[model samples]
Target: METKFLVSLMFLQAIINGVNLLRPPDQHGSKCSKNGDLNSNVLLKSRDVALDELYKSFRLPFTGAQRSNNGGIWAHALCPPKEKMEECRECVKDTIDFLKKDCPKQKEGATWSIFPHFYCMVRYADHPNQGNLAEWAWVQFNAPPGPGNATAGELEKAWNNLANTIMEKATEVKNLERYGYGSVLYGPHPQNLYGTMHCAPIIYQM
Candidate 1:
C-alpha cells in the first residue's frame, strides 16, 4: 500500500510537471481591459448562445472560443484546422460544459488551455457591447520528470522545447488563421506522437 501510494503521487506530480513544461502561459478569468466595456453583461443566455454559435462556425480543424462581437478574435496554437478540428472543438466544449455545471451562472472563468501542456484557454462574460480585452493572458506550467523512462531527463527537456516552440509560433499568427502547430518525439511505447493545441484571441478582443 505504501509503495502504491508513493507511485501514485509521483505519477500525479509528473503529469502536473508535464503540463507546466509543455503548455504555454495563458491568462485566465475576465479581467476587463482598458478598452473593454465592463457593462456588457455576458450573463444573458442569448449572448452566451451567440458566442457559442459563432465559435463553432469557424470550421477550423480544432476547437476555439471567443467573447463574441468585434470580429470574434480567434486564436489557436499547434494543430491545424485541417487536421485536429474535432479535438479542438471538443476541448473548448468540454471546458464550457464542465463550467456550466461547476460554476452555475458564473460570468468569468478560465482553464488550462492546453489539454495537458503549458497551453492555456480563457474566456469571460464580457459581451453584449461591454467590450473585451484579454489579448495576451499568461498561463505557465512546469514539468519536472518521471521514472520508468528510457531517457527521462532527455524526454522531459525535449518536451519543454516542443511546448515553447509551439506557443511561440502559435501566438504570432494573424487571427482567423490555423496552425498545424504541435510537437512530437520518436520512440516505441510513448514513441511520442501527435500533439494539438489552439487559442482564440479575436473573440475576446474588446
Candidate 2:
C-alpha cells in the first residue's frame, strides 16, 4: 500500500510539472524607447486612461473594442473566444497590471498571458490610430511533446497540414471574432494536434 501511494504521488507530480511548463511565462517581450524622445510620464497617464476605458467597455458580453487617448496613446486588449464577461474582465485586469509592473516607461509595450482555458493580450504605443496589420515584433514558445514513434518527415508533414488548415479556417469571414482554435488527430496512435490563431480587429479593416 505504501509503495502504491508513493507511485501515485510521483505520477501526479509529473502531470503538474508538465502543465506548468505549458503555461506562458509571466513576461514574454518588452521594449522601452532608447532614443528618449517620447515622454514617459505623459505616455503613462494616457495609458491609464486608455486602459480604464478598455476595461469598462471590453467587459460587455459578446463585444470587443479598442481604446485610445488624444495624446497619441493607444491600447488594444483581447480575451480568447467563448470567455464569459467576468472572466474576460479579470484577465484584462491581470494583464494590465502585469504590463505596467514589468515594462515601465516604455513608449510601446505589449504582453501575452495564457490562463487555463483562455489567453489575453495588452498592448500600447505612443502613436495614434496605428493599424494592427503592422508586424512590430513576434515571439515563439516551446512546442508540445511529439508522438513517441513518429519519423522526422512524418512530423513535418503533419505540422504543415495542421498549419494550413488553421490558416484557412481562421481567415474565413465566418470567424467574426478573428479567432480560431482547432485540433487534428494523426500518427499511428493518432495523437491530437491543437492550434489557435487570433487577429486583431484592425487587421480585418485593412
Candidate 3:
C-alpha cells in the first residue's frame, strides 16, 4: 500500500536529531524563475540587496522584505520561536547562501531548509504574492521502518495519533510566531514519537 502524509507547509515540525522517527525536511528544492530583461549582473545585484534586507528583517524570529521597482524581488525568512537568535540567523543564512550559489541569476527563487535545526524557511520571488498560502512548497522525509517488533498496524495507529496532536497544536494562534511542537508515546515501548509544526505568521494577516 502507498501511504501518504499530507502536511500543510504553513507549519514545519518533527524529526528529532537522533531518534530518526522521521527525517527532518531540508532544502527541498531551490526554484529559479527568469523574468523580464533584467541582465544577469543587475539580477544578482538586486537579489543580493534584497537578500541583505531579508536577512536583516529577522530582528524578530519571523519576517519578510521586498525590494526593487521593476518586477521586484521579495523575500521571507522564518525560524521557530524556540530557536536561539544566533542559530536562527545561521539557519536563515544557510538558505540565503543556497539561493546565492544555486540560483544566482534567477529573478525568483525559494528554499525550505532544515540546517542546524529542522524549523526554518527562506524564499524570494519577483511577484508580490509572498503572503499567498495557495503558493507553497514541501518535501516529505520518511522513517526507515517501524522500531522493534511493533506491527505495521500498531505503528500506523500511533503515528496517526501523533500527527493529529501535532497538527492541532501547530495550528493554534497562540502567538505571532504561530509554531508548536509535541511528542506522543509509541505503542508499548518506552520511546516517544515527536513532531513539530509552524505556519508563516503572515498567513494570519491574510
Candidate 4:
C-alpha cells in the first residue's frame, strides 16, 4: 500500500513537471536512451578546467549551479530564482545522485526534477561537445483533460508552436550561450501546456 501511494505521488509530480517542463528540460536522455550512467559521461569524461569555469559562471551570473569539464564541456542547473539557492542545489544534487541509479552503462543521461521551481537540466558529454544543444534535443509534449473547450486540435497546435519556437531560439543562440522556454495555464485546469527544448548550442554548428 505504501508503495502504491508513493507511485501515485510520483505520477502526480511527473504530471506537474511535464506541465511546467522548464525551459530546456534535462540535457541527458532517458535511462533507456543510452547504455551508461550520466556521471560516467559528464563528470568523468570532462576535464577539471571546464568544470571550474562552469562553477563560477552559475553562482554569479545565473545564480544557479554551474560546472564544466574537459572535452569542451559546460553546464548550468535550473530552478526558480525565487527559491533559496541552497534548496535548488540540494534538489539538483539529489537528481545527480538519483541519475546514478540509471543507465549503468550508457554513460550519459539526465532527469528533470522539482522540490521547488518548475524544471531543471543536467548535461555532460564526451568529444569536444559544448554550447546550447537544446534545439537538437528531443522535444516532449503532454496534454490532459481540462476544464475548457480545448481539444486535441488545440493541444497539437500548442505542442508544434512550442517546438518551432525552440528550434528558432536554439538556432539564434550562436552555438555557445544558453536558451530555453516554458509556460503554464490555470483556467484550463487540466488543459495542455508548453515547454522549451534544449541541447549543447554547438549542436547548431553541427
TM-score of 2: 0.70
The alpha-carbon RMSD values of the candidates against the true structure, listed in the order shown, are: 11.5, 11.7, 5.4, 10.2
Give one digit per residue, the lDDT tens place, for model 4 in 1-206.
43233222111122332344343333333332453334544454452334334424446344333545455443334454444665656556655554445533333444555443354444444433434232323324343335466556766556556555544553464623334455444334455454544433333232
Cα lDDT, all candidates: 0.39, 0.56, 0.57, 0.43
TM-score of 4: 0.51
Off by over 4 Å in 2: 1-37, 59-61, 64-66, 128-136, 142-156, 186-189, 203-206
Model 2 lowest lDDT segment of ten: 9-18
| Cα lDDT tens digits for candidate 1, 121-180 | 334443432223333332344445533253656665665555555555545656354232
Which candidate order results from sorting by TM-score in descending order?
2, 3, 4, 1
| lDDT-based ranking | 3, 2, 4, 1
Cα error, residue 36 of model 4, in Å, equals 6.7
**lDDT tens digits, residues 1-206, model 2?**
43223222111111111123355545333334342434666767877777767667753446433454536677777665566877777777787887787667767666666666556666776764444333332334444675456667766666556555655665689877765555666666666656555555662231
Clashes of each: 42, 0, 6, 25
Model 1 misplaced regions, further than 4 Å: 1-47, 50-52, 55-80, 83-95, 111-122, 127-152, 172-180, 186-190
Candidate 3 lDDT over residue span 19-77, tens digit each: 65333435344655545434666665766777777555456423331122222555667
Give the best candidate by lDDT.
Answer: 3
After the best TM-score superposition of candidate 2, give how far the Cα of residue 97 lies from its true spot, in angstroms: 1.1
Superposed by TM-score, candidate 1 places the C-alpha of residue 102 at a distance from the truth, in angstroms, of 1.6
